[model samples]
Target: MFNRTENLSLYIKKYPVISVLIGMNLIVYLLGLIPGIGNNLYALGIAYNYSISQGEYWRLITAMFLHGGFLHLLFNMFGLYVFGPELEQLAGKLRFFSIYFISGLLANVATYVVEPLNYASLGASGAIFGIFGAYLALVYHTRKILPQLKQLIIPLVAISVIMTFVQSNINITAHLVGLAVGFILGMFQFTPKRIRRFREK
Candidate 1:
């Protein structure tokens, strides 16, 4: 299964950023498992909370790369593999990265703002969902250009959202916030003029 997935991932060479991001996530995850090092990895999540109150707010951006457990990293990386390359291909790497990081940051901000006291959240769901939103934007904008893709987008997003709700211990707020931000950003990122310009021959 892993080999097959890797082979499939290779086809997305046009989107180098996705691959690099995935690699970074995996590396961090592995490094986090190194006994004492793992504690530091786990701390990255809560570190932001401490930093925020101390006026060193940049930890918000740093925490997105940290995951709490094997499954957490798995799901986030898997989601990125599933949605990220497509967005990268459509928007190009720089724009895709921007949307991803910004959306993730927004999700973190939402979490921090809404539940200021409960500060144990981590993972790249926000950024991945941003990619999901960007994908939605791309599909919606190009719906007229390529109507067939609509069938794929709607069902995939619906199923993912439903599954997110069903899964326990999942940060529902982060996912929703990420999706919402992604959807909103997708609107502007996939504007008609931009899409037309990107697709120009």
Candidate 2:
């Protein structure tokens, strides 16, 4: 049964974007593990505010795919795997990509603005937070479809708050900004026509 569940069509037909994203992240991570290539990649793309100021602007996006370690990669990928597909199916591919990438960039920008000059970070936490915020918005907009999600609101917020304080390395600025951006975007009332048709299947 578990094997059958793993072979479900939603992964292939509905969540191609998520599959591609995870594949890209994993490929980059593997490449980073090769000798000498790691430093070069980090130098070119990691989100060090100082490096970004010097005109390596691509770091803003590249950093989203770069992980600090295996556990970092695992957590971020897990979040994406869990939260991404339903939202993607609901919003359609283009809008889903917009929410993920745009919110991530804005989150990095917020971190740069609020944190110290020497501060540096990397990972998809901000993007995941955006997805989380988007999910919150969806739950608000379509409460009747998945009313049980309402139970998650307080715990999610409380956990975010607690994690921000307890974990010194976590980027609270990025997380909060991403969540705010996603929430605002989600308020735009964008239920894809495909979602309705797909659900009827």
Candidate 3:
């Protein structure tokens, strides 16, 4: 089953933009290892209490690239590495990029609005979830042609949603909100007309 999916390096070759994004995220992670500089870099994430409300709205976007710790960064980056390339290939570079940034921003916004008094939240999970959502949209949109993908996409989404609920300190709200927003955006990207045109072409 897994062998049916394309290799990551091949996918990146086909979609260079996603490669650059992955590189950028990795670069940011590396920067976060520079001793005091790393600490300062992390401090830039959207802190609901002290930082975000202080007009650091850019953190909504920036925080997507910042991570709390090694494991935190690893998981988010791994998710992006696995899913983002496929999404970019299916949606086209521009549309895929749009979904990632917008969904991530919405995730951060949801976090800020819902937990205005909470401490800082960071990582690319929102954006990664956006890619997952885009994958769902693409698979659903192309269901007639690629009916088999439903088995993969649907189960993955279900598992992710379940994990969101079961995990402690997992920022359930951000995950839910991000997923919701991503699904909405994915729907638009995979509108019937667009899908038909894409398939026809």
Q: Which number leads on lDDT?
A: 2
Between candidates 1 and 3, the one scoring higher on lDDT is 3
User: What lDDT tens digits, residue by residue, belong to model 2 across residues 4-107?
Assistant: 24454657666888888899999999999998998898778888888788877888899999999999999889878877877787777888888888889999
Candidate 2 all-Cα RMSD: 3.0
* Model 2, position 175: C-alpha lDDT score: 88
lDDT of 3 by residue, 1-201 (tens): 233265767766776876787788788889989999888887765445457777878888888887777788778766776666656655787888888888888888888888756566877788778877776777777788889988888998899989988877787767777777788889888776776666676
TM-scores, all candidates, are 0.85, 0.88, 0.87
lDDT tens digits by residue: candidate 1, 1-201 = 112244645655655887788888888888887999888666644425545776747667777888878888898887777667656766777888888998999988887777665466778888888877777877788889978877878787788789889988666777888888898888887788877776683
Model 1 local distance difference test score: 0.76
Cα lDDT of candidate 2 equals: 0.80
The regions of model 2 sitting more than 4 angstroms off are 1-4, 8-10, 144-146, 189-201
* Cα error of candidate 2 at position 11, Å: 1.6
Look at candidate 2 and tell me the lDDT of residue 25: 95
TM value for model 3: 0.87
The alpha-carbon deviation from the true structure for residue 58 of candidate 3, after best TM-score superposition, in angstroms, is: 1.4
Candidate 1 clashes between residue pairs 3 or more apart in a chain or in different chains: none
